[model samples]
Target chain A: MKIRPINHKKPSKIRELTYELKVEQVMCDDVITLSPDDTMNDVLRILRDNKIRGILVLDKDRLVGVVSIEDLISCLVDKGKLNEKIENRMTKDIVTVYSDESIVQVVNKFEDNGYGRFPVIDRDTKKLVGILTKGDIIDGLLEKLEIEYRQEEIHRYRASHIFEDVISDNSTLIMQYHIKGGDFKKAGEQTSKLRKNLLRLGIMPETIRRVAIASFEAEMNTVIYTPEGELIAKIQPDKITINTIDSGPGIPNIKQAMRQGYSTAPDWVRELGFGAGMGLPNIKNCSDEMKIKSKVGKGTDLQFIIYRRENET
Target chain B: MKLSRIIQILDAKILCNVQGRLDSDIPMICGSDLMSDVLAFIKSGALLLTGLTTIQVVYTAENAGVNVVCFVRGKKPSKETVDLANEKKITLLTTNMSMFESCGKLYNNGLIGGSDYEN
Candidate 1:
């Protein structure tokens, strides 16, 4: 369960790591399929009987459509679609797989396109071949977990070695910046990078997670509404502390911001399907201690700390 | 459909580690386009609807202890993402409806918020 420290040298060259992960290395072949000619009766029967969410649609023995429980439910509720054609009802313009792509490519496909089931087809024949379901993707993720966790453990071990040499009577201070507002794509960048650094530093796992959550929230909040903020972390011998400072439109009501339903995100953020306004709440939930300061016109700052484990010392 | 029923309906493979699979009937499921809100707000067993396709989505699910994720708008995950769900025992599904339409349909069909039926 030891994570290997990512060779820090590799980070600055993230682009170089792009092609490292392969697709076939992670996809699962165990998937289910349904032909396009199939009826709602058939699809619903399968969905209901099997307790599943989706069915791949094949036409002329080629991958064509995908049907899901939600689709069937919609049909049944309307009451006019009992016998409607599945091709008409099913979702078209489907995303597919060739089995030869990279794992990152697949991951990107899932993220960008909103697909969890892909009919793996032969490039030439284009047949409705093996199905790739979300289960298949989940399998891929878990595999990465092992790989990632190992790397982290290794990194932690190396960090421990470095720590021994440093003989830190105090925690190191990591200079940080508030994440820019409206930068969803880069939301996790700071935290993920910090996590890797911490792993390599051999910080305790529990402490690492706490820091991760706190940093992650601050990063997300910067994007949500702050317009700008910096998240600074300090690795002290006794505890870890993170401070997020921003200068955007500040929270008029910290109490309301702490509530789960309270959010000030725009329509686009919602369309991208987050900003349910849980960032601050989750941060508070994860951190052992939390502090927030804000001025209406001056933006906000979030400070949180989690102590080291007793046995680790 | 209930989460348990969805599992049974799909004969789905449980790909994540979960403790209470049968305690509640999942009605009124909201499908989103993001992974964060799903992780933060949605309860356990509430089937996720999102258009995002990534290992991070699965990671979010695993971290949140969620059991199932359904990609709508026909978003298909690659082998890597599928593989992650399998290892986590989280059920991954795909659908074709857009965010708004999908939720409306599910909501209309008794995937009602806070509506838990025994069936």
Candidate 2:
């Protein structure tokens, strides 16, 4: 692909939100339907009462056709009878979207077909359940985003209040998290949480960076090489210490594992941007002190420390 | 430098919504496919350029506090990766430029890389 010069648009959060929201979540289920036997005069009355631009023609519970404002205008233009049957004037080749489908697809359909509204059908039942308009989508997305913004504000407020007033000669914060093996999605979550806590405590950015990196690598190793493990961190006034204990198959060669570019990770793990044989070396490089002990067929315990020194960087 | 300026200099395409403003300045850039190297060296609020598009790349960026990640060599990540980036509020970008060329342009534009901080 050739580089496009300076015209790339960043994907909007509203656009991504569409992928997470279903059509039913935003659709108006209180649909006003015009039966096949209803006349053009009935359409005019329903359109005026509901203030809707498009109306669906239903035969009992099943949708048969759609009538738009243009159709009504055409009837007036032709000086046609207002008492004419609705289905005869309605568009038969109507397009629809499933209620369970993401709004992203609905947006695409809107663009492709140039339709003002879509009838939302239940995917499993194939029953017409609701009607959706552009206005509904915009309102739904805005409401969801507002809720998210409020929650984020609350989360930031909570994170800022890291420690409460307490009297003690020495206070150490201890955090423990269990890491499940083979769970790539949650591998670094504990470390990320720790980093946030450290930030809230007003620790130096550089110190927190080092501690986060070392702990993250250790956590990933436990998730990759063992069935399960526990990460425990002790935060002292002068330094931070982390220990990872795993009861899975232990490493037979600690020296080999410590070498850069030496990894025993499976091919699948390698494809996930890890297992480059740099985890142990990275842990060693970031920590001020490190040690590891393992027994074959048993388990392993790895510990590291990072001193909270001022002006170190 | 400003992330928008970096986008202009590298001809990059942003792939996700950023939590913060794009006009904000970043201190450094780190180019690496190995997530461990990125974790070990990258400073907070720096931009990361890598060819790896896995979910772990996003995780590494989160752990390291790197908010902006540019996937080099025209590498676009999967939907899962992009979704994760969006959820994490990290900005994702892609460019057709090679890792070497992208670094050179950013360097010429007065951006420093990770080596400047390594002791």
Worst lDDT 10-window in candidate 1 chain B: B15-24
Give the worst 10-residue stretch by lDDT in candidate 2 chain A.
Answer: A1-10
Candidate 1, B44-109: lDDT as tens digits: 456777777766576565444456787766677888777666655566766566667666766665
Over the stretch A10-100, how does candidate 1's per-residue lDDT look in tens digits?
3322322223434455544555666766688888777777776788776655667888777888887888465677887888988887766
Query: Candidate 1: deviation at residue A85, Å?
Result: 62
DockQ of each: 0.11, 0.36
Residue A284 displacement (Å), model 2: 5.3
Q: Using DockQ as the measure, which candidate wins?
A: 2
Q: A44-96, model 2: which lDDT tens digit per residue?
A: 99899888888999998889999989899999999999999987899988899
Tell me how far the alpha carbon of residue A161 in candidate 2 is from the true structure, in angstroms, after superposition.
1.9
Off by over 4 Å in 1: A1-154, A173-178, A203-207, B1-37, B41-69, B77-119
Candidate 2 chain B weakest ten by summed lDDT: B16-25
- Model 1 misses residue A310 by how many Å? 5.1
Query: What's model 1's lDDT at A134?
Result: 52
